[model samples]
Target: MKRTAEKVLSVISLVFTVLSVIGSFIFVAIMKTFTEGTLRTEIEMELYADPELTVEDVDMILSVLEYFEGFSWFIVVVLVISLIATIIGMIFMWNEKNPKLAGIMFIVAGLFAFILSPTSIMLYIAAILCFTRKPPLAAEDQSFIDNQYDDSMRPL
Candidate 1:
């Protein structure tokens, strides 16, 4: 059993997961810079252009930017773990060993698959294929059966 499709999907998922982790880092850096920069103050002033904007609301918005940046590290860590799981699954499938366990690993990785629907979808499909696919049944040789019949000589 080659498991070509599953292998391809897993590799693709691994790449996507890596990209997602890198993107998370970039996102956190950008958010941190935005929070600390004068642009934030400019944006605050712009929002205050609307006389209806209250001090509490402005403070909440500023705090949210910082919190989002803080939480992005958690996202990066999750994505890294997901990448590791995906790689382990790929290795198992590549060697055509322990496919059921590989599928289970994929499912576990899919739990936090980097917030990318396509990547997660690919992982899930790979898992399903691993679980449901089976090798073709072995066929007995006809020539051997004929030789056995000739030796027996008596038939019902």
Candidate 2:
């Protein structure tokens, strides 16, 4: 049985997952730099001029950046997990071997990374295809199929 659609979907989903991982790393890097760099000092200098802004507010903003930056690493971890699942599924799919297992992996990975829309959507569709597609039944010989003889076992 051919698994072209499943293969395509899995590859696309993998690509999207990879992109998401890269994006998360980029975001984390930017956040780290912002918190550690002179830009933070610049922001503090500007904020000090405001009459209503308290130290607590500035600290809160910085803390938020720190928290979310760490949080982005979690996102990367999730994406990497999904990426591994998809790769396994692709391996099974490409060989037309154990499609059901591949489908399961695809679905699990998709739901696991549901926050990543593109990755999840492609995997979901691919999984649907994998689960639904079936191999054609083998053709029977016409003579055997049309035989008129009674082949039933008889008790003499």
Candidate 3:
């Protein structure tokens, strides 16, 4: 049961991780184009009618926008890193080795997967499952346990 659960959860996590990586990259690319060209003009035109605003204020605002663009790129970098971490976590989950560490990696990925907020939430759930799930019994051990159970249940 735990093996099945872990496999399902790991596959789901991979799907979400891919979605998040693609979405984050697309969003950043679109935002970069918009901010570099149309956004500045839109902002200036929108603020043009304000009587209290001066040229310097507009300049400051555009500068701030530039800073925000840089910040967004930084976020994209973090998102990429988070995606990598998520893949690593998925690998660990699939191999069924060091689940506690895998859970921690998932948690870290979740923290950094901010662009697609739901992905982070899903990753967190996956992490929780990883941490709480029981390890699967070896096949021979499982067969032995089954035989013992059968003997115990027999009429004597």
Please tell me which predicted candidate would have the highest lDDT against the true structure.
1
Candidate with maximal TM-score? 2
Give each model's clash number.
0, 0, 0
Instruction: State candidate 3's TM-score.
Output: 0.67
For model 2, the run of ten residues with the poorest summed lDDT: 146-155
lDDT of each: 0.85, 0.84, 0.75
- Candidate 1 residues lying further than 4 Å off, grouped into runs, are 37-51, 114-116, 143-156
lDDT (tens digit, per residue) of candidate 3 on 1-156 = 455665566567667767766776776776677577777688788877688999889778778767767877787788787878888887777777778888888889888877357777777888888888876666664444445444656866
The deviation in Å at residue 3 for candidate 1 is: 0.8
Indicate whether candidate 2 or candidate 3 has the larger lDDT: 2
Cα miss at 5, model 1 (Å)? 0.6
Which scores better on lDDT, 1 or 2? 1
RMSD value for candidate 3: 5.0
What does candidate 1 score on TM? Answer: 0.79
